[model samples]
Target: MSFTLAIVGRPNVGKSTLFNRLVGKRLALVDDQPGVTRDLREGDARLGDLRFTVIDTAGLEEVTDESLQGRMRRLTERAVDMADICLFLVDARTGITPTDEMFAEILRKRADHVILGANKAEGRAGESGVLDAYALGLGEPLRLSAEHGEGMDELYHILRPVADEFSERAEADAPETDLDVSDDAPEDFTPSAKRPLQVAVIGRPNAGKSTLINTILGEDRLLTGPEAGITRDAISVSLNWLGTPTRIFDTAGMRKKARVTDKLEKLSVSDGLRAVRFAEVVVVLLDAAIPFEQQDLRIADFAETEGRAVVVAVNKWDLEEDKQDKLKALRTGFEKLLPQLRGAPLVTVSAITGKGLDRLHDAVLRAHEVWNRRISTARLNQWLGAMVEAHPPPAPGGKRIKLRYATQAKTRPPGFVFMCSHPEDLPASYTRYLVNGLRDHFDMPGTPIRVFMRSQNDKNPFKGRKKAPPSKLRKHLQGRKAD
Candidate 1:
């Protein structure tokens, strides 16, 4: 029954500061810059008995000439459309401006309920701006100093009425029938309070996946040796990394299906694939001696395609005498062989001697963080703007292709949806351009990246398409007449 409120205003008006104060968490990055908050940030909020969802938005800017504005519009519109109410924040010290009026006009057209807020209204200096906010015709502005934690009682009163109405409606629609809460409790199925992050360490048989995992766990949990196929079953172990619980799976080394003859080997390979599906992050190990072998690249590609966050670990670094030469060779191999997963992290480590183990952990953590990373619509578009300016989308049908908007449709492998005028006309090279741009901008080199193209002309049904096979579509289209 809690309502959703979006805090929106011009840049440097303390929107993020107020958001941090309201949420009681420093989730949003706060800086003394105009456009530090480029994306919309959502968090649960509370003030006294009133509880609701609050969204922190980027400073509203009038940008028509910028290519990134389209993406920002999509993001802002989504937030405004979803929210039941909005809190339009203004700097009481700065007074009102043309920018504030412009935002008021936009919000007046969009939001059902808009509450004007006069921030930094603690002293005489802010009184003029507080009075100026009333001119917008939104209503009497709530005065408060968010940083000093003043005027909270007024804020509570302002929001409590809305909270009560929502709660009353929710109660009116509630079901009256009661049932036993623990009726289906199992005798032996005690649910653990924590869910461990499932991670799969997979590569060619000779690659030191088991060794690296054993190093991570700081124990010889999995049997390790020189021989291939020594570990057949996909053995999993529960462990903690810096207090975060994780389930690391040591999958059996996968070989070419043509060479996988025995029924048992086939089952093992199937189990490995199953592990890949279950994993949230996959560490694709590669032997430094023979880095980026056809099979190693294939494993990395599979991880990316399956939407699993991938990290490449080049094992046995201690044995390599020419470190720089080997690393250069490895990077070249990755860029050439697995261009699809262009910026995937490639951590060089000695799994046998435990050198660079800490770096490997850092790299894995960074990759995981990036996998879960969500950029504000504003920031993404800003970055997108720079990218487009650097290299525009290719020409199609004798005209320039326009990439209208981009947003993260999903993540885990960090999938993005780029809405455009011509999805089919967007060349693969252009997609690569964006992918490489993302990798470089985000410092997520050597990690799997995915960008999905969708036409703004039609609704994209991302669902069920995962199950649809391209071969089937080709088969159905074979010998078909042009429409």
Candidate 2:
């Protein structure tokens, strides 16, 4: 395992900015607000040739009350405990505030390895604040400008020794391996066990996405409460579910585009979309009380359009009084609202009580298998012939359109290509007919299918050739004989 570094400090001190710089992407949401980030976001960071796992944590607050700020502080403290080193950042422009002093003292007591970094230490503007940071007595602070890309070399110099020590420890802890092989050994063709399945849980605000994940993990690993939009970044957690290793991403609740006006919310939504694109399977969490809302439909449609395997998880099932009727209505409404995902799995579960979780797990695995399914070319052509015979192509302008053959182009959403005489003449309705046929006949329920048409080019070889005057001579001879 790589070394872990946690960035912890009071809010709005450029911790996320430095995180984005090190990770080479803007994975965390950053804004002028004090507590924009509310979760622990992890990313693999690189500095020069040094690589390590870096965590962007919520700002620490000096509060022990059961308020939101206190919860966030507790989460950050957990991150500090998990990290190999903590990078405590302070805003040099604002000087050392009382909050910073309180956090510094906390880190001194809890974390064994701490590196004090004075951010925004660019030009002479922050010289006084940098000097004030020395009073904390942790050590001489490393002056850094996270926004302007300054002091990175010094940061690297300080991190190199730590990285080397981690590498040495890992090498010493690793067990030795010994194996003997024959000179002409046959290669194994059986499919090896796949890597952990990447699944992302997504939904609107207060839909219990984090709560559902925490239930799956059987622990309070994620911070959850009655607050809407509690999760701001896409946080990933790895776990073994029934002997299957899986990596689950808990994302911020995505609101409608029109309602998303805040810059931080926009960034959070974008991050959620990125997680969807990266995931192999996405679970669209819906509130059972008000299911299939406009935003929920939009979210499901977006996932289908992205060619991802989708499973609808209706949360808060425990709150419903009428179970049988609600389940029937939910199924009917789901099919009616999102016909694109016609047969997608709809599993009802109460994230708080952990009911129906087993069914949800099975549905997710089944959807993933269907998403990765492949069909043989012969079977595809046979199915295509049957489909074409059942519903012949439309003849427009008295020109008959012929679909020659079909072949599977790719899997993982199951794409196919059809050779035809006139590709453009094929109507959208007919294309849908073929796609639906593939989905139904091939038993590929709820999986997105792509069908492409290709027209054959048939050109005449003897074009633009002029004929001799033999026709005129033959006509004259025929007239003379008739006379």
Candidate 3:
């Protein structure tokens, strides 16, 4: 029964700050730079006893064309149409400008219940702007300092009646039912709903990360154009993707570290890296015409090193002339360049035309399945014996190494620990041999496989110690008679 409120305004008007305040979490990235938010982000919000849904949208722009700013403006206008109420934010220090007036007029035409808010109106410097907000004919403006947590009481008061009205309407419209004094449950709540799968899309600049996300969403939800690095903040959107609940993050294109000098770009890259860390499946998007650049390899390698399930998606595939030949070349190059990711799915997709999306979805799911693949101890031991017999462990310095046992220590980018003699002396080449053996034998291709070597001697608590003298056990035995 709670109403949905949308915060809409021009760039850098503190809308995201107010949204963070309302949600009581730093879900949206905030910066001094304008146009930080590029998509619609929704959060469950609470103000005192009133609970509702709040949406933080991209900043309103004046352009109405096909440019990026125009697209952003259209998206913001869409939010106005969708929300039950609109909180129009204006920069009080800057005073009511032509953009604020335009936004007000738009809200007057579209929004059902509009609440004018003069943000950053804490000191006397913004007092004139707060007064000017009233002249827009939107009634009294709620003076707010979203960052400083001022005027929230006024915001709550203004929204309380609207919430109550929604509650009453919902109650009146509901069918009568038997009531129990202790029974408190939502009528439409489903307890078995699974958590959404986390997927992050990353690549170099202009690799169609945003376009792919938009195609999947089947709408112009994200601000996308020909611009490189159009996306920042690593915005995440939720959807039921082909019967699977998924939370997919759209990240800013990450360039080489040497090229990332700007402070904002550094933050954006950091955010993208964070998204990759939390993501279960990372889609390394690439340009079809220029696939597998050094940067692309690094991005995919980062995901692999982080133990994330990886899917290499070559975007703009629709532009390719010879599809079959190009696909063969791509596969050949993938195998030759990235032996660690052998057998991992490399799906060709067109973010614009939505070509081969279904195949990409299947590939992603398959990679995740392999990432979480687990083997029984008996099976692992059997496989280890065969692998050792096929290629015996090398002897070093006249000492032979013995492979005692192998067991999977973790799933989700499956990690295994091997108990053996002289594990420290084992060469990394042998480890790679075992890892590749495991991938081919267990059918766990493409996903990163972690192998850890542990020595049987390592289990001893007195390791690396000279015992400091005779053991206390020996002393006690000496003291004891012939017991």
Candidate 4:
């Protein structure tokens, strides 16, 4: 196993800024607000040749109540426990405060290894504060400026030995690799077990998205409460589900565009959208009592537009009294509201009580399979021929449109191209018919399917054409023609 490092500090101390620098991306949300980072975020960090998993945690606060800050503190403490080493940060410019001293004592008691870092130590301005960090008794504080990219070499020097030890231990624990050769076996197209499945859980505000993810992880890894929009960033967690390695992203609740006027909410929504785009499979969580709302349909539509494998998860199912009737109604509503996602897996789950999660998992796997499925060209053409025969292309302006051939262009939300005489004249309804036909005939239900109409005439209109003459030349040519 690789080494894990957790950056623990008080709010507004540039821990997140340092995290972005190490991870080589601006992933964590940074603001003047103290508690912008309410959850622990992990990323693969690299400094020089040393690489390891680094966690950016919420600011350490002395709170134990059920308030937001208290919950954030608990989550950060959990990150400290999980990490192999803790990089406890203090603001060198402001000097060590009471909160920082308290956290340092806690780390000394709980963490196995702790590295002290004095951030914002860019120049002589912070020298006095850096000296004060020595009083924390962790060690000689690494004088660093997270914003100005200073002291990275010193940080690297400190981490190299830890990384080397981890490497040696990992090598010792590694099993022997078999070098047997097989020449007669066919190559497998299925994804390997080693690669974790990437899944993003998304929904509107207070749809129990974080709750469901917490349940899946079987721990309070995420902060959840009666509050709406408690989550502000797309936090991802790694897990082993039913023997399958999976990385699930728990995104902030997305509100409708018109209602989202707050700048912070907009950023949160954009982050969630990015998560959906990056995810291999997206689970659109819906409130069981108010399932299939306009925003739910919009979210599902956006997923389809992105050509991602989609699974609809109705959360809060335990609260529904008429289970059978409600499920039937949900199915009917789903089919009617989101026809583009017809036949997609719709699993009822209660994120609060962890009901129907197995079904949700199975559905997600099935949807992923369909998304990656590829059809043979011959079979695709055969299906196309049958579909065309059943419903011939409409004749537009006395010319009959002919679809000459059809072939799958790609998979992962399977796209196809059709060679046709008049690609532009093909009506939207006809395209829908063909797409639905492909879905039904090929058993590609619930996956977004794309159909492209290509004009068979490949001849360039400008090929072998002479350049137009200038005005004078044109006049001379006209006079010569007259003569």
Best model per TM-score: 2
lDDT of 1 by residue, 58-151 (tens): 6777775434443444556567778998888899999999988988998899999888999989889999999899899899999989889888
Candidate 1 residue 125 Cα shift, in angstroms, is 95
Determine which window of 10 residues in candidate 4 has minimal summed lDDT.
186-195
lDDT of 4 by residue, 268-330 (tens): 888889999989899999999888888988999999899899999999989999999999999
Residue pairs clashing in model 1 are: 39-376, 343-445, 343-446, 343-447, 344-445, 344-446, 344-447, 345-446, 345-447
Model 3 score (lDDT): 0.89
Backbone clashes, candidate 1: 9
Q: Summarize candidate 2's per-residue lDDT along 1-483 as a digit string, tens digits.
A: 589999998889999999999999977887888898888888989999999999998888878888888889888999999999999999998999998888888899999789999999999999999999998888999999999899899999999998899999999999987877465856332122346888999999999999999999998778899989989889898888766678899999999899999888888889999999998889999999999999999999999999999999999999999999999999999989998998889999999999999999999889988898888989988888888899899998888999888988887678999999888988999999998888889888887888899987667665556765578889999999999
Candidate achieving higher TM-score, 1 or 3: 3
Model 3 C-alpha lDDT per residue in residues 22-73, reported as the tens digit of each score: 9998877889999988878888898999999999989888898988888888
The per-residue C-alpha lDDT of model 3 at residue 168 equals 98
TM-scores for the candidates = 0.52, 0.92, 0.88, 0.91
Q: Which stretches of candidate 3 lie over 4 Å from their true place?
A: 168-193, 457-483
In model 4, state the lDDT of residue 371.
91
- In candidate 1, how many Å is residue 56 off? 50
Clash totals, every prediction = 9, 0, 0, 0
Candidate 2: what lDDT?
0.90
Q: Candidates' lDDT values, in order?
A: 0.78, 0.90, 0.89, 0.90
